[model samples]
Target: MAKIAFILLCHKDPEGIIRQAERLTAVGDCMSIHFDASAPKSEYDRIRKALDGNPNVTFARRRVRCGWGEWSLVQATLHAVEAAVSAFPGATHFYMLSGDCMAIKSAEYAHDFLDSADIDYIESFDFFGSDWIKTGIKEERLIYRHLFNERSNKRLFYGAMELQKRLGWRRKIPADLQVMIGSQWWCLRRRTIEWVLDFTRKRKDVMRFFRTTWIPDETFFQTIVRHVVPDAEIRSRTLTFLMFSDYGMPVTFYNDHYDLLLAQDFLFARKVSPEARELKRRLGVLYASEGTEFRISNEGQRLYRFVTDRGREGRRYAPRFWEAEASLGRERELLIVICKKWHVARRLAGIVRQELDLPVIEYLFDEGKTELPDLGGIQSTIEKRTRHRRALMRMLFDYHKTDRLLVCMDPRNFELLQDFCADRATTRLLEIQCRFCDDYLTGHAKRIGLAGEQAGPEAMARLLPTIRNDLRHESDRIADAGFAHLNRMRETAGPDENAVPLAAFLSIPEDKARAIAAMENLFSD
Candidate 1:
C-alpha cells in the first residue's frame, strides 16, 4: 500500500477535524494536525481530545496566529510538513488537508490517482499582470496608509510594489519548458515535499518574499514550487474538498445542483451541514454498501433516492416557483418606463395615480428626475435592470410607497416590476399589455365624462389631446396583436368552448368579433 501523510491545519470546529481524520484514515497511512495557538482554549482542548487515541495522528508542538494577508498560515503549514517528514519518514506522499474539506470519493481511488499522477495540484496565476491588480495598487496603498502607522506603512507600501515588480519579472520559458502551478490542496510525492521544504530553507530571498507579502499562504508554495521545478507534474485541476464560502462555514446541500456533483471527477468537497441528516444517511449507505439505491423518507414523503449505476445521471426537473417569485418581489422598485412620446407617459401616469392611488414620477435621463424621473428616453426593457438599474431601483423602492403601482409601456418594460412584485405577497400587481396610445385613451377616458366633460379638466386635457391620436393608433395595433396571440392559443388549447382567453380576461385589447369566433375555434383545434 502507498503510504500517505495527511497534514491538516485546524483552528475552530474540532468535530470537523475528527470527520476529516476519519475520512483520511480510509486512504492515508498517517495524519498530523496543527492547531492555531490563537484559537479559543475550549476549541484547542476539544481538538486534542478528539484525535487522542488515533495511532496515526500527532499534534504539532507550535501554535501560530493566522490572519488574512498574513504570513502565519504559511509558517504553520511549513512547520506541519517538517514534522510530518520527521515522524512519517517512509510515507510515499504528503497530502494537505483542511478541517473543512471532506472526501467525496473513495480513499483507495483518491490514493491511486495521486500515486499515478505523481503531481502537485496547486493553481498559480500571474496576479500582478491582471488589470484589476494594476488598478487596485493606488487604492490598496491608500488603505494600507490609513490602517497602518508610519513605520509599518512604509514597509507595507514598498513591500507591495516590490512584490508586484518581482512577480512582473517572469521570463518567457523556452519552447520546451513545461512549468505548472499546483493546487493548494494536493498530494505530492515525498521527494517533491522534501524538495519544497529544502528549497524554502536554502532560499533566503524566498523567505523575505513571503515575510513581506500579502496572502503568503497562497503565494509562498506557489512561488517556491514554480522557482524550483518549472516542469513539475502539477495537475491543472482536481476535485478536492473545499468550502463554498469564504469562512468555510457549514451549509446544507439543498440546491438541485447537488445531484450533478456526483458526476464530477473531484474526490473531495466541503462543509456539509450537520442538519443534512437525510443526506448523511443516504451517503453513509452508499459508502458502506457501494449501492446507489438508497432512499430516505422525510415526513412520509420519499424526498430523494441515490442510485449507484455508473450511467445514472441525476436529472430532476422542477421549476422553483417560490424562488422565482421571491426574486421578483425583491426587485420591485427597479423599474423604468420608456415610451416614444412624453404625453403618453403623463396620461399613463395619471391613470396609475388615480387607479393605484400611488405616486407617479416622470423620468428623463438627461433632465433626471427632480422628484423621480423615468429613464431619459433610454428604451425601458427587461435588460435595463443591470447594475445601474439595481441602484436606481433601490432609490425608487426606498422613496415610493409600498402600495404604489408602477406603469411601463410593455411586458419588456415591466420586467423589473414583475421581478420586484414576484415576491411581494402584500402588493397587488396588474400588468397591462397596452401601447402608449391605448394607455392615454384609458387614462383620458377614465377621467372624462361620457358627455366629454372632464372631472379634472385642466389635468385631463394636458394628457388627453396630445395622447388621443397615438392612443387610437396603439389601440388598433394592440387589437391586432391580441387577436394574433389568441389565434395561436386557439390552435393548441383544450376542448372547452367556455374557456376564456387569458389576455381577454386581463382586458388586453383583442378583436371582439374575432374573439367570439375563436370561442368555437378552441375546441375545434
Candidate 2:
C-alpha cells in the first residue's frame, strides 16, 4: 500500500483539529498542519502541545493569515503542502483537506479507496463561464480585476470596482493561460504537488495575476493543474462532501445531515460543528465504532426522516405558488444539464447527478413544449423553471446564488449556453459526462477480463488486483462559438483568436462585435 500524508489548512477550532489529528494517528496516517498566521502564537503553542512529540505529525513553520477568496488562502495551502512534502518526502500520496473536514469512512477504507484510485482526485474545468462561480457573480470574479481583499471597506471597494469595470479596467484573463477552477480540496501524489509548486514559482506572472483575482484559492492551484499537469493521471472530483448554504457559506452539519452525509460515497465531510450537541454526540459514537461499511442506526434514520420532513417544507425552488417566510436555500453547487429537448436533458441530468454527486438543475432552452422529464425511479429532477431559457436566466441570475456547472449534453442547447458563455465567462461547463463511477467501473471490469458477473462496489474492490484505469485526458468538446477562444488556447494558436478580448465584453457595436467574434472564429467551430 502507498503511504499517505495528510495536509490540513485550518483557521479556527483547535479542539476539532486535534481530534482529527488523533483520529488520523489512530488510523496510522501521518499529518502536516498549518495554522492561520493571524492566530496568536499562544494558540499555536496550545495546538503544538496537543500534538507534541507525535512522530507522525509535523507543523508548518510559515503560518499564513488566510482570508476567504484572497491569495492568502492559496498561500496557506501551499505552505501546508510544502511542509507535508518536506516531512514525508517519500510518501506516495498526499490528501489535502481543511481543518473542519473529518473522515466519514474508517482509515482502512479511506486508504483502500486511495490505493484503488490510480489518478489524482482533483476537479478542474475551463474557467470563464465554465463552472468557476455562480452565473451573476462570474463576470465579477473572472473578468474584473479584484484589487481589494475582504478586509477592505466593501461598499467603497465594490463601488470603485464597478467604476473601474466601466472604465475598461476589467480585462479578460490572459490568453497564454487557461483558467481552470474547481473545488479547492484535493488528494494528489507527491510529484503532482511538487510540479504545481515548481511551476507556479517559475511563472511569477501567473502567480501575481492570481493574487489580483478574486478567490485565488479556487483558481490558482486548479489553473496550475491544467497548465502543468493537464495530461497527468487525474479525475475531476473531490472525494469530500461539503454542503454550502445559498450564499456559499459552509453549512454546519448536525444530526439531520448525518444520514445524508453517510449516504454519499465520500471520504470526508466538513464543518461538523462542535456546537451542535446531538451532532457532536452522534459523531463521537461514529468515531468509536469501526469497519468500512457505513450503516445508519434505526435512531439515525428516524432523526433523518424528521429532518427531511421539515426540510421538504422548505422547497428548494420557487417558480410559482408557494408562500414562505424565507425562500428555500439551494445546493451550493448545481450540475446544470443543458440540452435541447426536455427528454435528452432529463436523461442526461439523472446520470450526471448520480455520477457527479451533485444536484441536477436542468437548464433547457429549446424544449418547444415537450413535457418536462419525470426522471422516474432513477433520480428525481427538481423542476427549477428548467425548460425555458428566460426562466433559467432568472433562476441563475436572480434568485439562487450558488455555483453552477453547466453541461452541454447535446448540440441543441449549445447556442443558448453559448450566449451565456459570452456573458458569464466563468460558469464552468462540461461537454463530456461519465456514468456513475461505480456503474462504469463494474461494466469496465467485464471488458477488462475480470470475473465479475455482478459489478458492485465490493465485487470491483475484490477485482482491484490492479487499478486498470481508463479515465479521459483532454477529452471535452468545444461546440459553442462563445468558447472557441478556449480551443485556440489549447491548440497554442498565436496572437489572434487566443482569448476572449476585453473589447468583446465592452459594449461594442453589433457589427463590430460580429467582426471581433468572426476574427476569433467564435461563430464557427
Candidate 3:
C-alpha cells in the first residue's frame, strides 16, 4: 500500500491549516508543515500545539520568510520536504499543498490512486519553448537576475532588469539542466522526491543560480524532476484542482462553489476561502468517509468554460442603450429600416423580407429581448447588446449562409446609425418618417416597464426632434409618411410596382440597387 506524505506551506489562517492537516492525516497519511517565518508567532503556536500529539504530523525545523519571485519560497518547500522525508522514511509518494488546500476525497482513495502507479504527477514544460507565461519578462526571467521582490518593489525590480539589459549581462544555465516551468503544486514518488533533495544538496552552483531566479519555486522542482525522470515516468500534470482569474490571481473557492468543488476529479483543491465553513464541513465528511465516487459533471465544465471564455474574450463591451453605437455587420446586403414607431418598421421589414427572400429581424436594437427570425426571442440584457450584434452578424454571414439581412429598429437608437450605414458598398439605409405614433410609443413604454415617466406625449414631443435631426445629418433616404401610409401598405399586403407613392417608398431605388450590385463583384469568393 502507498503511504502518501503531504507537505503543506502556509503563512496565515492557522485554524484552516489545522483543519486541513487533521483531514489529510486522518487515515494514517503523514504531513510536514512549514509556517512562514514572517507570520505572527501566535498563529504558528496555535497550529503547532493543536497537531503536536498527532504522530503523522510534524513541523519543519527551519521556517523561511517567503516572498513573491524570490528563493525563500523554494527554500521553505525544501525545508518541509526535508522534514517529511526524514520523519516518514517508508512513504511511497510526497504531495505538495498549500495551507488553503483541502482534501475532497478520502485518504484511502488517494493512497489507492498513487499505489497504482509510481510515476510522478506534475506540470512540466520546456520554459523557452512554451507559451505558458502570458505577460512578463519571459527569457529574461531566466537569464537576468531578479534581486528585488516583484510584489513589494516592482519599479526597482523592473528597473534592475532594464539596467542589466543595457549592460548585456546574462547568466548561462547549468549545462546539464534544461529550464522547465510548471504549477507549484505537484505529487511525486518518494524516489523522485529523494533524488531531487539529494541533487539540490550537492549542486551548490545550481542553487546559487536559482537563488536570484524569478519565482524559483515554480521552476526549481519542475526543472529538476524533468532533468532526471524519463519522459514515461512523469505525468506532467498536477493532481490538485486550481484556477486563476484574469489578473493571474488564484481563484478562491467558497461555500457557493459546492457543486463546482464536488464535481472535480482531483483529490484536492487549493486556495479555498477560510470563511467557507459549509464547504469545509461537507468536504471534511467526504475526506473522512468512504463510498463516495468522484465523477466529472457538466457544472464543472460550464464553470471552466465561463472562466476561460471570460479570460479570452473578456466582458462584452456595452455602451449605454441610448448612446450605443451601431456595430457594422459583415460585408453583405444589409437594409436597415428605421422609423419613429417600430410597428411600421416591422410591417415594412416583412414586405422587404417577402420580396427579397431575406431574413428580417424585428426590433433588432430594442432594449428588451431581441426577436430573431427563427431563434424566437433571445433574452438580451442591456449589457449583452454587443453580443447580440455579433450574433446578428454571424447569423447573416455565417450560420444561414445568407448574404442579405433586413433589420427593423426604432429611430430612438439612431445615435450611430448614420456612421454605420454611411458605407454604401454593402449597406442601404431607409427611414419611414411617421407624422405621429403615440399609441405605439405608449405601448412600447408600458411593455418596457417605463410607462410611469416615459409614456406621455410630453416626453415623446421633447425627444422626437432630436432623434429625427440626428438621422437627417448623414442620411438622405427618409420618406415622409404617416400611419395612413403604413395602414395602406398593410392592407395592400404585397408590393405594388405601379402604385403611385407607396411603390416609390417600398421599392429599392434604381441607383442604390446598381451601386449595391457594383460592389458585389468586389466581395465575390
Candidate 4:
C-alpha cells in the first residue's frame, strides 16, 4: 500500500473537520491541517486538541484568511501543501480535500485502488465548450475581469466587472494560457505537487492574471498542470461526487445521498452537513472493511493494463515535444529576461516591458532570501532546478530566439547558465557588475504605490540612457543621453557616484602622493 497524505483546507464545519481528521489518522493516513484564520479561535483549538501528540500531523503555521473565490483560497491550499511536503517529502501522493469530504473506501482498498491506477484523476474540461454549464457562465467567470481585494468585496467585484464589460473594456487572457476549468479538488503525485509549487514560484504572470479572475481555485491548478506537465494524461473523472447548484455552489450531502453515494464506487463524497450524523454513521458501517486484505490476479492485471495503455505511454514518451510544437507558432516575441532572483526579475521585467513594448517574461535562475516557502540547499537545490528545467528543455530551448538575459557577476553562478543553456546562443547576454538599484529607485517608487507601474514615454526616454547597456551593439543609440547629463552634473553639481574629485582622490585612498598617478598601472595603458 502506498503512503498518502491528505491536505485538508477548511474554514467552516469544524465538527466535520475533526471527525474526518480523526477517522483518517485512525487508519494509517496523516494530515496537513490549515484552519482558516478567520474561523473562531476555539474551533482551531479544538482541531488541534484532537490532533495533539500525533507525530504524523503537521499544522500549517501560517494561517491564512481564505476568501471563497479569491487567490487567498489558493494561498491557503499552498500553505497546506507546503506543510505536507515538508512533513512527508517521500509521500506517494497528496489528496486535497475539504472538511466535508469523507472517505467511503477502506484504507486498504483506497491504497490498492491508487496503486493499481497509473494516472492522475483531474475532472477537467474546456470551460468555453462545456455543455453542463450555460455559455453565460463561461463569459462571467473566464471572459470578464473580476477584481477582488477580500472576501467581503464580492459585490464590488461583480459590479465592477459588469461596468467594465459595458464600457467595452475587454478582459483578455494571455496568449500563453490555454484556459481549462475543472474541480478545485483532485489527487496529484508528489512530483506534480513540487512541480506546481516551483512553476508557480517562477511564472508570476499566470498568478497575477488569475489573482483577478473569479473562482480561480477551479481554473488555476487545471491550467497550470495541463499546460506545463508534459504529456500528463488527466482522467476526466473526479474521485469525489459533488452536486453543484446553478450558481456553482456545492449542495450539502444529506441522508438521501446514502443510496446514491453507495451506487457509485467513488472513494469520497463532499459537502456533508454537520447535522448528517445518521448519514455519516451509515457510511461508516457500509465501508467498515478497513482492516481487510484484498488480492488481484493476472486477469485483473491484464484488464487494468489494457484499460490504462494510454497513460503507460506517457512514462516513456518525451512529451515536451508537444509543448515545443505549440510554442513555435506563438506570435508574441516574448523576451525572457533572466534574473538572479524573483525580485530583480520583477523589477527588470517591468522596465523592459514598458521601455520596448516587449512581451516580457521574468525568470529567476536561482531562488534565495524571501518569505515564500522553499527547501534549503545551495548546490543540490540548483542541481535539482537544472534537472527540472531539463524536463521542459524543449520549450525553454525554443524560446532562445527572443530570450533576453540580465546576469549578475557579484559572486558568479560559476557556469550554471552554461550548464542550463548549453545548446542555446549566449551572445545577447547583458552582464552587470555593479550594485543593484532595487533599493535605490524601485523601492522608493513602490512605497509611493508605483510598484510595477510603467513610466511614461517622456520619462522612459530619460531613463533609458541611465539603464541601457554599454556592451550592446545598439548601445550607441542612447550613448549621448545619460553621459551628457552626467557631464552637466560635473559642471553644475558633483563629480561621480562617490562624489570625490581628482585633487582629493589621494586623500580618500592612495599609496602614492597622487591617486591618479598611483593607479597608472591599473589603467589600460
Indicate which candidate wins on TM-score: 3
TM-score of 4: 0.52
Sum up the clashes in candidate 3: 1
lDDT per residue (tens digit) for residues 1-525 in model 1: 568788888787777667667556644468878888888978888877877777777767687876554677778888888888888887887777776554554555555667676667665554444332322332233112122222446686566556655676422322332223234666667877888888777767556544644445654676566555545576545356342222333333533323333333565555455555454444433333332421111111011121111123222212245334333243243223334344444554464356436566554232233344464432253334322443444445555645333533332223333333344422232222223344445453554321132223433344355445544444344344322222112223332421233223323334432343243322210
After superposition of all CA atoms, the RMSD between model 1 and the true structure is 18.7
- Backbone clash count for every predicted candidate, in the order shown: 24, 12, 1, 0
TM-score of 1: 0.49
lDDT of 2 at 300: 25
Of candidates 4 and 3, the better by TM-score: 3
Q: Superpose all Cα atoms of candidate 4 onto the true structure and report the RMSD in Å to 1 decimal.
A: 26.3
Error of 3 at 455 (Å): 48
Compose the digit string of candidate 3's lDDT tens values, residues 92-120.
88999988887777776877888788699
Residue 176 in candidate 4 has what lDDT?
84
lDDT of 3 at 491: 23
Candidate 2 structure quality by residue, lDDT tens digits, 1-525: 766788888877788788778777664678899889888778788889999888889988688777777888888788878888888766778887887676666666667778885778887878755754764456577677776664566776587688987898867576688888899888887788889889877988777678778887777877787776655577877877776654656766766565556545677787776766566556545654666475422222222333344334324332232222122223322233332223444554454446444344543333233333443311222233332333344344333343544333343333344444444234334342223244444554454334224334544554343333222211222442445333212223322442233123222344443343333322121
Once superposed on the true structure, which residue ranges of model 2 sit more than 4 Å away at CA? 129-132, 150-152, 256-259, 276-291, 294-525
- CA shift of 152, model 2, Å: 5.1
Candidate 4: count of backbone clashes, pairs at least 3 residues apart or interchain: 0
lDDT of each: 0.49, 0.58, 0.70, 0.57
Top candidate, metric lDDT: 3
The parts of candidate 4 lying over 4 Å away from their true place are 135-137, 149-155, 166-168, 245-249, 285-288, 291-525
